[model samples]
Target: MRIKNSTVVITGADSGIGRATALRFAKKGARVVLASRDAAALETLAADCRRRGAKALAVQTDVADPEAVEELCESAVGNFGRIDIWVNNAGTGVFGPFLDTPLEDIQRVVDVDLMGVVHGAREALEQMRAQGEGVLINVASMAGIIPQPYTSAYSMSKAAVRALGVSLRSELRLARVKDIHVVTVSPGAVDTPFFDHVANYTGQDTRPIPPTYSPDKIAAAIVNVARSPQRELTVGLIPKAMVAKHKLFPQAVERRMATLTHRKHLKATQPAPPTKGNLDRAAGDDATGRRGRKTGGHGGRTKTMARRLLVIGGAAGVTAFAAFRWRQ
Candidate 1:
């Protein structure tokens, strides 16, 4: 579908991937509606989009609240006349041993990460079904596929999101809703404020896993998917290969991922106190001491790590395919 003049709504638009995606859509001449718990930030983003010559509206929303999400949809239609694309990008996470993590924090993660997607998708689908044509993009994560040991809640919520996309597609197919589409995007570790805003109980500082791609990269993927919808998309090359490997060797890959997450995802040397980071409310600039920093939690080895992962993934993909063919 053409993006120019398309009406698009993006949640979690205050910063990170959502923020980037909103800007990309704006640049493409799409009418954009920005949603987030941070009203001021959303207004700023809306102004930025308008400056770029796109119609934009800032709606302060907590995606966990179904009513608020419903209002968000109404606002979009009232302003733009129709909904063409809805990106369910609002999410939060918790990182700690399941037993050590606070129960409330676990619930909050589900509320924001899982239920938030649920609310956005539900509201958007209803609007799309009425219009008979639209796209719904749900942002899941690699953790949903390869299991992270410490972040049980976060992983579970993301896994559920992946399942939700599958179920929605099946339902749409059965109903012969050909024009309406549901797309799931599973992104690899990304350079976003997510690590900084995560609820951490590990008694250590958190960081994104290696080979972290910039939020802009993921934003581009989301925008591309909106133009040409697909049932599912693994955004990064490394994540795509790891997903394939997991399909062939779930147990081995799961074990290796668990080990890597322990060694690299969390920084034991950098001790930090536990806090409920952005799970319940919007953790604005003051949440992390670096007030204006939007991304860059990962180290500076992104390009190098990506190259290494690509080589390893290519070799693994060839070997795996060859082995399967030999058995057949």
Candidate 2:
């Protein structure tokens, strides 16, 4: 589909992948509607888009809310006359042992990361069916394909998103809606404020940030998907390899992950102060008043040790697999 002159609605547009995508689309000559719970940030992004000579609107929306999503769709169609693309990019993460993680945190993550995508797709489909031409882009993650230790809830949510995309794509085809496209983009670790916002179950005062790719890298992939719809697009070499390895050698991957697991780190006994400066708070969604305050927990020597071991192990596994594939 041609991106020029199309009207697109992007959730989580306050920052990160969503914000980058909004800017990219606007720069590509598409009218963009930036939606997120953060009114101020949304306004700033929209203004930036306008500065780039593109028509833009900021809609303060909590995608987890069904009514809010409907309103978002209405506002976009009302203002722009049609909806061409709907991007479900708003998401959050919580890390720690599944048993130790707060139920509230789990529910929140599922609601935002999974149900939020569902709501966006439902609203987009309703409008797109009428127009007979639209694109639904769901932003998943590498975790969706290969579940990681200590991030069970996030992994589950992303896996569900991948399933949702596949199901929706087939349903759309069966319904004979050739113009309505459903695409999923799975990105690896990205340089976003995601780590800052992540709920920690380990009770650590601060969480360690992982190696990351730029948000612009994923944004470029999303633009490509919109232009030429695909079933799925995996971002990053490591993540792509992990997905392929999991498919080809599930047992080997499972053995490696288990061997790399940090059992000692899982026992974070001392609760430190909670962390602060998460993107959620930055976006002004600190409704719980927990913004800018540490959540709690001291650093765990064992946890750090475990992370290092996993990194080394993962690298070794990837190298071995790559060599084998090259030889083949």
Number of the top lDDT candidate: 1
**lDDT tens string, model 2, 1-328?**
8999999999988877888898899999999999888888888888989999899999988877899999999999999999999999999877676887778778878888999999999999989999998889999988788777777888899999999999999998888778889999999766555655666666653333234566778888999899999889997655666676787688887666544434422324546454322324443553212112221232111225565576567767867877888899
lDDT of 1 by residue, 217-324 (tens): 889999999999999999876788788777777898899999898988788888989888878788776322211232343432366755876768675776778697
Among all candidates shown, the one with the greatest TM-score? 1
Candidate 1 error regions (>4 Å): 286-301, 305-327
lDDT of each: 0.86, 0.78
Q: After superposing candidate 2, which stretches have Cα over 4 Å from the reference?
A: 205-210, 255-282, 285-328
TM-score of every prediction relative to native: 0.93, 0.82
Q: TM-score of predicted model 2?
A: 0.82
